[model samples]
Target: METPPKTDIAAALNRVLLTRKERLRSKNHWAGLAKIPTTTVLDAFKGSNSTIDTLTKLAEGAGMTLAELLAHGDPDWEVQVKIRNTFRSWTIEDVDGLIRLLERRSGPRDSDAS
Candidate 1:
């Protein structure tokens, strides 16, 4: 299957901020959290194999919560389609709600914690 649209997937994963630079507010925020030089973070929105920790810091520095970071957006990635012989169910709607609910439940991350 074709990969989802880059924007769609990126937004869903909360990495859109890195690409758009909206997730970062100031140089000092990253400096205080990540040991990496401020320039490095700026250069690498595309951090290879980087974990959520880095993403969290980026979001925090930008004053956004992790859940805010990971939101798949209003279109909703969980809004998928399933077909059966004769019965039809709105699984996508339910799934989308669940994902959004989960996102809301996840609070912000600590800047100091390891």
Candidate 2:
């Protein structure tokens, strides 16, 4: 299948920030999260060219990978990316526990009913 065109980088970054509005109340908050200067964050939001390192820091601040941040248009993919990023630091037992909890909350699957 043909790949969908990506959104502008600045717009994608803005969308991610909107999703994190509760925590990132302002640009300064975002910069703090990214551990970058406020001016750098401002430049990024304005579509100014930034170094890969800066972009990586920004992505990390947003709880996603650099790739995910760059490809941040799809809501479903965004959620999956966040989940995947979270899973990276989890133990297998933690993952299994989460699976069990989710399954319980979601009830039995069709296969289980059979």
Candidate 3:
């Protein structure tokens, strides 16, 4: 799956930080908790000079897992989330049946059979 755009990621992180009851006091607080440099966090918010790993650390400090952060960060996250959730409660048999059904529908039709 495609990573969220940097701007969206920055916005999501800011939203999380701003909305939490236990608000971050400063960039230094976030940097310490996230175990990254303050400049990294600052640069991330500005959508520059931040690696995925650095951003993930900040997300964790903001009380979000990487996936949760991405869910908030990416506008297109819902589709991928829905697709993943679709199989979450399925049994092995259900998956097999789904695969078989898909294969049948997607395979060559009788009219095309040689």
Q: lDDT per model, in order?
A: 0.49, 0.82, 0.72
Model 2 worst lDDT window (10 residues): 72-81
Model 3: lDDT equals 0.72
Cα-based TM-score, every candidate: 0.33, 0.59, 0.54
- Candidate 2 lDDT, tens digit per residue, 27-71? 898899999999999999998887899989988987777877776
Q: Per-residue lDDT tens digits of candidate 3, residues 2-26? A: 9646547676667656655375666
Candidate 3 ranges with C-alpha deviation above 4 Å: 1-7, 21-23, 76-114
Instruction: Tell me the tens digit of each residue's lDDT in model 1 across 28-111.
Output: 455455555566465444334445676576556545455554543325523321122112444787779978888788866578
Provide the lowest-lDDT 10-residue window in model 1.
78-87
Global local distance difference test of model 1: 0.49
Which candidate, 1 or 2, would have the higher TM-score against the true structure? Answer: 2
Superposition-based RMSD of candidate 1 using all C-alpha atoms, in angstroms = 16.6
lDDT of 2 at 83: 72
The order by descending TM-score is 2, 3, 1
TM accuracy, model 1: 0.33
Ranking by lDDT: 2, 3, 1
